[model samples]
Target: MSQFVIIGGGVIGLMTTLQLADAGHEVTVVERGECGRESSWAGGGIVSPLYPWRYSTPVSRLASWSEGAYPELAFRLLEETGIDPEYRQKGLLYLRVDDEARALEWARAVGKPLSRVGPEEIYSREPQACPGVEEALWMPTLGSIRNPRLMQALRARLEAMPSVSIVEHCEVKGLVGDRQRVSSVETSRGNLAADQVVICGGAWSARLLELAGLQLPVRPVKGQMLLFKARPGLVNRVVLMDGRYVIPRADGRVLAGSTLEEAGFDKQTDDQARESLKASACAIIPALADYEIEHHWAGLRPGSPDGVPFIGRAPGWDNLFVNAGHYRNGLVLAPASTHLLVDLLLERSPIIDPEPYALEGRVGHTA
Candidate 1:
């Protein structure tokens, strides 16, 4: 069995490790901070893409595959670890609170079922919905997952795997190798050798590559989100309006988020962004105005210029790979991405094309 070392302990890293370990590979995950507490934990856990049909064919394919995988993965983890990821298929309502014409047109183009729901119908669907919510486009197949619980369950299962080792607080300093390939990783604790190294550092991917004398075209796009304490059934469906979303969890907490900022590595939650999110959320569901703000936080999404993630091997480095730059769709794309990586490592057929996500052409040079 191949010995693999994965960097970053977020969902992608953890999920990839789980898959590899399950396949009988010896896996070690090195995390700088608390495991599974970075962007993965901070994410809103929407299992579906914001607009799946609008994305590229590869992206849509990956999203669809991952969506199908969620149920089985959630069930397995819950059965083994006794932790519910709160996987729910409550559907999603995309409303045009301000510009109905454009929203309706876009919804029609995307083949989403459009409905002209009056105040009464809206209230019937969600009694706590705002008074002004006129009409919405509904996609009933979309779903969500409780990201933290999912991470916890995956962590527990990984801990049970004798082939998987999780080393937290072990900051990776750089890659240890020559220009052709990576032999191992240099971490704060010391050097650890591996047969293969996959970097899943998320927003910090660029910095991590720089340490290895490689330039990657990855940047951090900051997103700020807010949390509210409210009953779950109050909003049974996820609501998207005016570039903001309201997600109701099984627990008595409603998540209203988020603002996309092109800030570099800044995890601070700006007051203005938080206030704007609150305003937009209240505009969609007026009762949110009465709910106390329980938490406000931010995460940096790894973004690329073409809105596509970088996966597969980095140029000039054999067995050194990348699975980052997922941007906003990291959670929804995790399963498919991990599957593709495993297939690539195992020399099996990949589900998606590796060209667009290849690290070589974009980064130009190799480490």
Candidate 2:
């Protein structure tokens, strides 16, 4: 069996480690901080892209495949770890869509559940929906998993696996070896020799790649969100409008977010973000104005230019692979992306085409 070291312990790294270990490869996950305490935990957990038609075909393919795979994974995780990921198909509703024809066509192409609905239909479903909307798009298959709980379930399940080991607060400083392969990892704790290395670092992936003489553009995009401790039934499902969304969890707490700011790595939550999100939430569902803001936080999502992650062997490095730059859809894209990464790493046929995410010609050079 080969020894694999996956850098970054967020949802992506943890999921990748799980798959590699399942294949009987001893895998170690190294994280700069606590696992799952980054973008994976901070996101709204929407299983589909906000605007499906806007993303490229590669992103759509990965997301479409992962959308169908989450339910069974959530169920199995709960049964084994006793931690509920809270996977629910409460559906997603959009107050206004700019390109109805394109969205409908794209929905048909990808086989995702979507339909055009009238204002009355929206009100009948979500009584607290925003007014003055003529029509809306209802996506019955799209839903959310409580990502923090999902993280708990994954970490718990991986902990029990003898082939899997997670290293927290262990910073991976650089990659050590020739261009043909990464023979070891230089970390804060010390050096780890590995037969293979996969860099799953999120926003900091560019920095890590720089150590390998690559210039991939994986910048950090900050998103701020606010939580309202309202009743569970206040909003029936997820609401989307103007690139902002409000998610209602199974518990009494509701999540309204977020702001897409190009703020480097500073994840500081400001008053401006809180007010902006609160205003949007209240505008969408006026009942939210009655509740106090319970939590305000921010996370740096790995912003990619085309919303597609690089998931293939690093150019000029035979045993080095990358699966980062997933932008806003990492939670939904992790399962399929991890599968593709392991597939290429094992010299097996990939689940999806790997041409778009290749590093030499367009992937890393673009960044």
Candidate 3:
């Protein structure tokens, strides 16, 4: 069995460690901060991409497989760790679908149910959340998870695994060894020996890979979100209009978000963003204005070129792999991305085509 050291303890890294440890490999997760508190915890946890029919092939493939796998994964984590992920099939309500033809065609091809709902029907489901909508598109199978709880459950589950060791507050500094293989991972605490290393450092992936002389085009895209303390059933399902969305939890709390800004690692929530999000949420759900804005926060999503994540062996390195640059889809794409990485690592049949995610044409080692 290979000894694996995974840098970063975000959802992507945690999932990778879980699969490898389950396969009887010795795994150590080297985290810069507390595990499971980054983008994974801060995301809205939509199971599918914002619009599955519109994304690239690589993203859709990962999201498609993961959308099916989540229910089982949630149940398993709850049973094992006694932490509920709160995975719920609340469906998705799109107030405006620009290309109806393409959505319907893609829905038919995927064998998933997509239906048109009039203003009356839309109001019936999300009576207060949607306003002045003539028509809408509804996907009943779409689901969401309480991502913070999901993170907690995964961390708990990983801690119980005998083959897994998680080193929180330990920052990975560099890669040590020849170009043929990575002998160890240099970190803030010390160096850890490894047979193989996987970098799941999210937005910070590019910097980590830079230490190994490769240029990965992963950077931070900041997103800010707000939460409203409302009664249960205020907003039903997930509602999206324009580029923002409102996710209603089972307990009546409502969440509204976010802005995609190339802010370059800035995670501070600003008043402008908060006001903008509040206005948008109030517009979607008038009742939100009545309730108090309970909280506001921000997270950095690992942005990549063309919204496609790099998830394969690093060029010029024999033992290093990457599963970062997922942008806002990290929560939706975690299961499938990690599965594909582990499959390639084990020389097993990949869940999907691995070539699309290969790191071949991009900038290779420069430093």
- Poorest 10 consecutive residues of model 2 by lDDT? 358-367
Total backbone collisions for each predicted model: 0, 1, 1
lDDT of 3 by residue, 276-335 (tens): 999999888888989999999999999988888898999878989998899889999999
TM-score to true structure, per model: 0.93, 0.97, 0.98
**In candidate 2, what are the lDDT values of residues 106-136, reduced to their tens digit?**
8888677789999889988889887778899
As for lDDT, the candidate ahead, 1 or 2, is 2
Off by over 4 Å in 3: none
Compare the candidates by TM-score and give the number of the best one: 3
Model 1, residue 46: C-alpha shift (Å): 0.8
Worst 10 residues of 3 by lDDT: 358-367
lDDT of each: 0.84, 0.89, 0.90
Model 1 TM-score on a 0 to 1 scale: 0.93
Candidates 1 and 2, the one with greater TM-score: 2
